[model samples]
Structure formats: structure tokens, C-alpha cells
Target: MAKLHIAMYPWYSFGHMIPYVHLANELAARGHRISIFVSKKAHSKLQSHNLHPHLITFITITIPKVDGLPEGTETGHDVPMELNHLLCDAMLLTRQQVEEILTADKPNFVFHDLAFWIPQVTKKLGIKSVCFLVISATCMASGIKPFREVTDDKPLTEEELTTPPPGYPSATVVLTLDEIMSLLGASDFSGMTKLHEGFTTSMSDCDVLAIRSCTELEGKFCDYIQAHYKKPLLLTGHVLPEESESKLEQRWADWLQGFEPGSVLYCAFGSQYVLEKDQFQELVLGFELTGLPFFIALKPPVGCTNIEEALPEGLEERVKGRGVVHGGWVQQTLFLSHPSVGCFVSHCGFGSMWESLVSDKQIVLVPHLGDQIINTRLLSTDLKVAVEVKREKNRWFSKESLNEAIKSVMDKDSEVAILLKKNHLELREKLIKPGFSSGYVDRFVQSLEELAN
Candidate 1:
């Protein structure tokens, strides 16, 4: 086999960027040359991770300013909820720059995430292009019908939007009308339209499709996508990063050390979601009801300077010695792998879900937005490895409901807990099987090499 040079562009969000970096590392380890193009702000975030300097190159693209987007916001995760579309619009503006760089570099192949314009440019340059999905196969599979059927002029009917797409599995999870409306409403509805356009164009123009999923976990969904699209689909197993040896900061580490092994619950919503003060208060009360030691890492809600201000008065003291609230950044993977951590109460982001799966932790899913709702449904309804916090009338959960879900998963003697633990362990074993994820990466590299030839 000959060494190949590949160019990669992912959506600006860290969730998308980090997986692309992981794939790049895997390819580089196999002796390939790789270039990753990202916005300047995104490049700064990537710098914190140890990437292969020799085999991988980081090319920074400037995000053009757009109305509603703050000056420094480069990714969806960095901005307020309503401004996400501006980030997408700004990314679209970089098409010209991306083309110029790719044209000069003249890489044999280009892998892109959600940048629909790339295929047109790559086509003109005669470079092979692959559309990379940074989300779950089930979610992607669910979208196939809508993307094919819905058009800019002919919008999806309310029923079409609410119902599962045709050919989706009978048990396929569909987002509620309210959840869909909330997702679109957050970005003023235009964001979803842009995304629909992007997916439609990219799927039509790309040479192949690649998704970050494994057959062991989502084989049926993967097969459905391949059969539906009539295109070659690559399943690049969940590319988990190597565990970090670095310990948490002294304060957090010392606090977690007080809990018995596998006795504490760790709660974290990924960096993107912000909770309302009322919702934050409910979560605090729910944790208090659990009576088990726990730690939560969250951003202070709007108008609050710190977690203490956002939390109910003296709630921290009430749960003193049993609960630790850390604001700002947390070493999530480290905490998930920590010996003292027993359960994870999470927003069910794909990255967080993968980390939980890799760590084999009991999960209490509380999906907040976007594909998280679908991911939660898949985990709880299809996989049955995690339990979802019960929602009231299909809306956000009450504190009592949250507490019940937590206690249900944490109780070792309960049948439901036993089953969840069994499933978690079984999944961990499957994922760790020799060459499980590596094999998928190897095959994907081989396909790219073939295209390069």
C-alpha cells in the first residue's frame, strides 16, 4: 500500500471537529498524510489536544462576519442558541477560501462534514469527495427520507415532519412536533432549512458516505442507509480517543475521592446546552433527593455570575460533602472513567453517549435538544442500556421524575438496574473486541486509497 494525502473539513463544532481529528490520527498512524481545515477559533480549540504534528497539518480558515454572529464565535457550540445559524452562514462564506487551499494543495481526496458546497468545488477540482456524518446512523437514516422528499419550495408537512420517514424501522424513533419546532425555533427556522439543503446537496454529489457508527451497535440502521441511498456507506466505528492519564484538578479530584468506588453519579451536559434557572433548580433538588454523592459541571445560567447564584439558596450547603458543583470546563472523559463514578446523568450528546458506552457507566439520559432526543430514544428504547428521565406530557422532566429515573438506575439490586448493567458490560466487551473500531478505519482508509489511485 502507498501513503496517501487526504484533506478533511468538519463542521465547526467541537463535537464534529474532535471526531474528524480522531479519524485523522487513525489514518496518520497508518502512515498517511492529512490536512485538517478549520476556522481560526476552532484551530485554537484543537490545539489543546495532542495531534500528530508530522502526519497531520492544521489549516485555519477565517469565518466571515455575519449578522447575529458575535465577532469571535466560530462554532455552533461557542455562540448563543439563536445565533447558531449565523455560524452556519459564516461557514458557508468560507467556501471560496476552502476551494483556494484545496486547489493549491491538490489533495487526492477530500472528506467533509455538513459543508454542502465542498462537493461542487471538489468536483471542479477533480478531487474525490466523501460526505462524513458526525452523528449517529439512526439519526442519519431517519433523515434520508425527509431529505429526499422535502424541498425548499415544498416544505415537509406537519405530519411528515412528525412521522418516521418511510422505510425507517418500525421501532424507529421520531422527534415530537414540539421538539422539532423547538429545534427550528431556536435558530429562527432557517437553520433547519439550510441543514436540509446541505444534506441534500452533499449526499447527491459525494462519491461516498461515511458515518461515525459501528455495525455492532447500529447494523440495521447502517444497512437501511446503504440500501436507501444506493451508495457505498462506510461505518467508521465509534472512534473513541485513548484514555487520558491526567487527573482532574485538585479540588474536583479530592471531592470525588471521598465517594466509594462506583457510588457517585456524574452529571454533565455537553458544553453547548444552557439550562434555565428554574430547570437548574429542579436538577439541584433532584440530586438532593438521590442522597448519593454526585458532581455536576454546568455553565452558570444567563444573568447569574456563578453556579451558586443560579442554584437554589443554600442548596450546595444542604447537599454538602455529597455534591460538588463545578462551573466551566470539566475533564469529562476522565470523570466518566473514574473509579468512584457509578452513573452518568447526561444530555445524551453523541460524544457523551459514546464516552459512557466506552466507560460502561450506568446512564440516566435527559436529552435537551437536537438529535439528542433521538439518541436518547435509541439508547433507552432500542438498546435498553440506558434509562431516560421521564418527561411530563412530553416536555421537560420534573425534579421528582428525574429523581425516580436516577434512583432506578443506581439501585444495584433492582432488576432494571441489573439489566442495564448487563447491557452496558456486553456493549463494552463488543467495543473492545480486537480491531473492532480499527478494522472499520482501516477499511475506510483502503477505500480512500483506492479513490486516490
Candidate 2:
């Protein structure tokens, strides 16, 4: 294949940027030149993920300041979910900047997410604009469907969301009352545009559509999206590095070494979402109830300044030796790769979901967002490789439910546990078979090449 120059414009969150970097690396390794756009701050953090720095360029995006955001707040890390729209509005403010860059640089293709207007700029500049969604096809098919375009301003009622959107693939993916209420709380994407508008418009107008998923994993959903969008929808097949180069931090390595192989549990929600104080307490307390050693790394919960400050009384002392509730970041791959970590409790973010699937660790999900909820259902229901922690009517997971999900998997001899283990291994092997991911990347690049010509 001839060398291709591609531009990547991912959303400002690490969840979005990191996957774009992975794809950039994949393209770069195959002798393609890549330019990735992110804010200066996000670029600083994302620098390490770029494996082929020589072939891949990081272009700093200048985020225009908005009223509600702190003077220098360019990404979501600096703000709460309630204040995220300001950042979204700020990201949209860069339409001129993005337009200028694409016009001048003139890459063959520009892969973007959430910036609905990029397609217009790319089309004007004779560039192939691919809306490379880092989310699952399941979420895309269910949320943004083949039917009418849902406007940004309409508020969805519980009745509307509890059932899947029109022409959605399956009955297995309906939302719970709790999920519906949570969606209502978090629906607005600020004064600029809603996520539905961004996704639908981006998909509808783009020259090509690509998803960071595979037909092997979400075949029906992928097919549905392509058939409806009537565009060149390419699957990037979980564009992740073959191996993590970073080492396990010494502190984590030492602590994990104390436990027997496949004995400890490692729980983490991704950086963006934090559990409520009560739910956080229940989670750690549930670990204590397991009577097994666990390492849980999470940000401080609501109303608390630190993990220790939020713990239930006497619970820390009771589980001191066996449990660690760290409030800082840990290298998740190292934790998952460790022999002692037998079970993983995750939030089922797209990235976390893939890591969970590729590892031997038993899976337990506690999803918080819309995409996460669908991802959890996919893993727990269709794949049957994992189990989801049951949520109460109020949408909080209790210590008992947490303990029960872990126990259901940790008890290897039990029928349910055995079934999950067997199914997980089978699926993992099939997905990661030699050339599986790279093959998809190759085909994705070819599709973009065809579109570019």
C-alpha cells in the first residue's frame, strides 16, 4: 500500500484520545504518517502512548475559553460532569482552528469523534473525513439508529429510553428504570449540541465511518449501523497495542507479590467517573466481606477529599491488611497481568471492557454511563463471559451485591463460575488470534485509501 497521511481528532477525554493514539501507532507502524490533534494538556499526557513518535505527530489543539470553565480548563479532567458542557462548547469553538489546520496541512484523511462539523471542513478541503468512534458498535446501533435523527434539545423520558430505539437489533439491550433516570440527569451536552446530534451528524455527513470494534464481537450491531448509514463503515478491531511496555510500579508489584496466584481482586473505575460516597464505602466494605485480598484504586467519592476519609467507620481497620483503597492512578495492565489478581471489577468503559476480555481475570461490571451500560449488558448477557453487579432501585450497588458478583466468579468450582471462565477463555482466544486485530486495521486503512482516492 502507498504511504497514507491521516489526521486524528479525538475528543479531549483520555478515554477517547488513548484509543486514537493506538490507531495512530498501528498506522504509523505500517509506514503511514499520522497527525493527532488534542489540547496541549491532553497532548502532554498522551505523549507516552505514541509508540512511533517519528512517524506520528501530536498537534496541540487550542481550546477556546468559555465562561463556566476555569481560565485554562481545556479537558474534562479539570471539571465535574455537570460542568462538562462548557468544555464541550469550548471544543466546538475550535471549528475555525480545525478548519485552518486541515486546509493547510491537507492530510489524506481526518478521523474524528464528536466534532460534527469536521465533515463539512474536510469535504471542502477534499479530505476523507472518517468519524472514528471509540465506543462500541452496540452503543452506536442502539443509541444512534437507522431511523430519524433525534434533535439535540429534546429530553428523553423514562418510557422512551427503557426500550431500545427504533430498529435496534435486539431485545436483550433494554435499559433499567435506574439507567433511564441517570440518563435524564446526564443527558444535556450543553448549549452547543447533544451527543446524539454530534454522533448522528458526524456519522451521516462523514466520508467514512469507523468504529473501534469488530464484527466478531458486535456483528449484528455493526451490520445494522452500516446498512442504515449507507456509508463505508470500517471496524478497527479494538485498535490496541499488542503489549504494554510500561512496568508495574514497584509499590504495586511488592504488594501484589504477597498474595497467592489468582487470589486477589483488583477493582477500578476509569479516571472520569467516581462513585458516590455511600457506594464507594459499600464497594470497599464488600471487598472486606470477601475475606480475600484486594487492591482498589479509585478517585475520592462525592463529598470526600480522599479514599480514607470516606471509608465506613471501623471498616478500614477491620480490612487493613487485606484491602487497599488507593486514591491515585495505577497501571491497570500490570495489575491485570499479575498472577495474583484473579478477579477484576470494572466500570465497563470501552477501554476497560477490552482489557477485561483479553485477560484471564474473572469479570464483574458496575457501569455508570450510557455506553458503559450497553457494554456491560453485552459482556454479561450475550457473551456470558462475565456477570454484572445487581443495582438497587435507587441505582446504587450494595456491599452484598458486590460481594455476590465477586463470589459467583471467584468460586471456580461452581457451575456459573466455571461456565464464565470457559466462555471467557474461548472468546479471548478467538478475538486475539494471530493477525485478527492487525488484519482489521489493514482493511480499515485500505477502506480509507479507497475513500481517499
Candidate 3:
């Protein structure tokens, strides 16, 4: 066997980019060469992690300015929801720079995130390409089935929208009307259509499909995807970084130290989700009602400068000593792994889910958008390791609902709490034990090597 040179490109979101970095580092540790293509902004974040210099190299590419996009918007996290489509459109412009790198480097294989056009470029250059899915296997399987089988442009009927996609009989995950409307109404329909087409073409044309999940957790969904796509699929496990000792900020450390062991609730929506004023207030009131110590990191809604302005007046003072609210970055892993943290109230992004799972924390899900809704279903319905907040008719949850859900998870005698605790412990044992994630990465790299040869 010979060492292989690989090229990797991920979508401009941190959720997408960080997982790819985990995979690249794993491959590099196994003595392979990996070149990562990222924007200057993303490259700076990657460099901050201080990745292995010898085996992994990052190439910076300029994101071409689109007319409607804000100046210097290079990634999904930097742009607003309405302008996300323009970001996607801007990525297409990078094809020339990518082509130049491909021509110069001639790596054995290219691993790309859902930028559908990458496969076409690989095909033209006669390089093997793999489609790396950064989402759950259920979301990928469900999302692609319609694009692959349904040709009609007609909108889905109420019944059609709520049912599981064909061929996934065991899957309990289905899109609600609210979820469907959010997707259709959020951005340019044409852009979304193209993105769907990209998924189909990328899966149909790629040499392999790699997902950031394990058979232990999503075996059934993975099997369904393999049968449906009729392509070799690789499970990349969680591709999470190994837990290590790191310095925590003294202010947060001291605050967390004051709480009883495993008694604090940690709340954070990922980088992309912004809370409207009403939602923010409800969450604050809900957490305050729990009467438990909590730490929250939130992104203010558009035009709001900080969390204080977005929160209800006197809310912070009312919850004093019981809650700590920070608007900007908080080291999530440190907080999740802390001795005082018990439950994670999250947006249910895959990255956050992985972190919560490995940290052995009970999850209280408040899914806001996109695949998160599916993730919430999977976590609560399929896995039974978390409980989702009750939503009302309009899909909005009341503060009472949030408070009740948190109490249900935190109550030691409750069946939901006991079951979640049991499962969380089992999952943590599986994830943190040596070689659990690495085994999957090893097999994935071997499969890629075999394909390259």
C-alpha cells in the first residue's frame, strides 16, 4: 500500500467545515496527504485549531462577490438567511480556482461537500470524487428520495408532505407542514431546486457516498440509502475530535463551579440560528422557571447588538445568580464536559448532537430550522435519548412548554429522565471508548484508497 494524496472541499458552514477537518486529520494521522480548500475566513478558523502541518494543507480561495450578498460574506454563518442562496451561487465561481488546483496537484481522489458541480469537474479531469454528507443519514435519504423519483413540479399535498419517503418503511421521520413551508418560503425556490438537483447528480455520479454517522446509531437509514442509491456507501462515524484537557475561561469556570455536579443546563443554538425577540424571551422565562443554574450563549436577532437588548426587560436581573447569559462565543465543549452541566438545550444540529452525545448530557431539543427538525425527531422518537419541546398549533412553543420539558428531563424519578440517563451513559461509553470513531475513519480511508487504486 502507498500513501495517497487527497483533496477535500466542504460547504462554507462551520458545521460542514469542522467535520471535514476531523476526517482530514484522521486520514493525515494514518500517513495520507490531505489538501483542504476553504475561503480565507474559514481558513483562519481552521488555522486557529492548529492542525497537523505536515500531512494536512489548506488552500485559500476567494469567494467571488455576488450582487446581493453583503460585502465579505464568505460563509453561511456570516450571511443572513435571505442571502444564503447568493452564497451558494457565489461558490460556483470558485470552480475556476478549484480547477486550477486540481490541474496542478492531480490528487488521487476529491472529497467534496454538497457542492453538486464538483463531481462534474472531477469527471472532466478524470479524478475520483466522493460526496460527503454532513447531515444525518435519515435527512439525506429522505431529502434525496423525492428528487430522484418524483418529477412533478406540483407542490406536495398535505398527506404527501407528512408521510415518510417511499422505500423507508421503518423510518418514523417525516416532514411537518411547517417544516415544508419554512423550506419553500425561506429562500429562492429555484435555488433550492438546483440544490436538490445537485444532491441527486452528486450521489448518482460520485464514486462513493460518505456520511458522518455510524451504523450503531443509523444502521437502518444507512442501509436504506445504500439500497436506494445503489452506490457504495461509507459510514464515517461521528468523526469527532478526541477529548483533551483545555483551559477554560476563569469567569465561566468559576460560574460553573458554583453549581452542584450535573445540575446545570447548558443552552446554545449553533452559529446560524438567530432568535427572534419573542422566542428569546420565552426561552429566558422558561429557563428561569426551571430554578436551576443555567448558562446560555445566544445570537441576537437582526439589528440587535447584544443579548440584553433582545431579552425581556428586567429578565437578567430577575434570573440573577441562577443564569448567566453571554452573547458571543463560549467554549461549547468545555461547558458540555463540565461537571456541573446536566442537560443540553440545543437546536439539534448534527455537530451539537454529537457533542452532547459524547458528553453524556441529557438533551432538551428546540429545533429551529432545516434538518434540525428531522434531527429532533430522530433524537426524541428514534433514539429516545432526548425529549422535544411541545409545539402549539402554529408550531410555536410556549414558555410553559419549555419549562415543562426541561423539568421532565431533569426530574430524577421521571421515566423519561431515567431512560435518557441510561441511554446517555451507554452512548457515552460507546463513543469515548478507544477506537470507536477511529475504526470507522480507518475503514473509510481504506475504501477511498481501494477506489483510488
TM-score of each: 0.94, 0.93, 0.93
lDDT of 3 by residue, 74-156 (tens): 98888765565678789888999999999889898898866778888888888988888888887777665453233458644
Query: RMSD to native for every prediction?
Result: 2.3, 2.6, 2.3
- Ranked by TM-score, top first: 1, 3, 2
- At residue 102, what lDDT does model 3 achieve? 98
Answer with 1 or 2, whichever has the higher lDDT: 2
How much lDDT does candidate 1 score? 0.82
Question: What does candidate 1's lDDT look like per residue over 365-449, in tens digits?
Answer: 9988767887888889888899999888847788899899999988999999999989989988999888887888888788777
**Clashing pairs counted in every model:** 0, 0, 0
Candidate 2 structure quality by residue, lDDT tens digits, 1-453: 578999888877788889999999988988999998888889888888888989999998888989878888977777765565567678789999889988889999999988888999988888888999998888778765333334556644446656676777877876775664343224442321355567788889998888999887899999889988898788889887788677899988998899999999999999878788878888888899899999999999988888879988997778877889899999898899999999999999999999999899999999886578889999898889999999887777888999999999999798989999999999899787999988998898787777766
Q: Where does the lowest 10-residue lDDT sum fall in candidate 3?
A: 181-190
What is the overall TM-score of model 1 with all chains considered together?
Answer: 0.94
Q: Please report the TM-score between candidate 3 and the true structure.
A: 0.93
Model 2, runs deviating above 4 Å: 145-157, 177-193
Q: After superposition, how far is residue 239 of candidate 1 from its true place, in Å?
A: 1.2
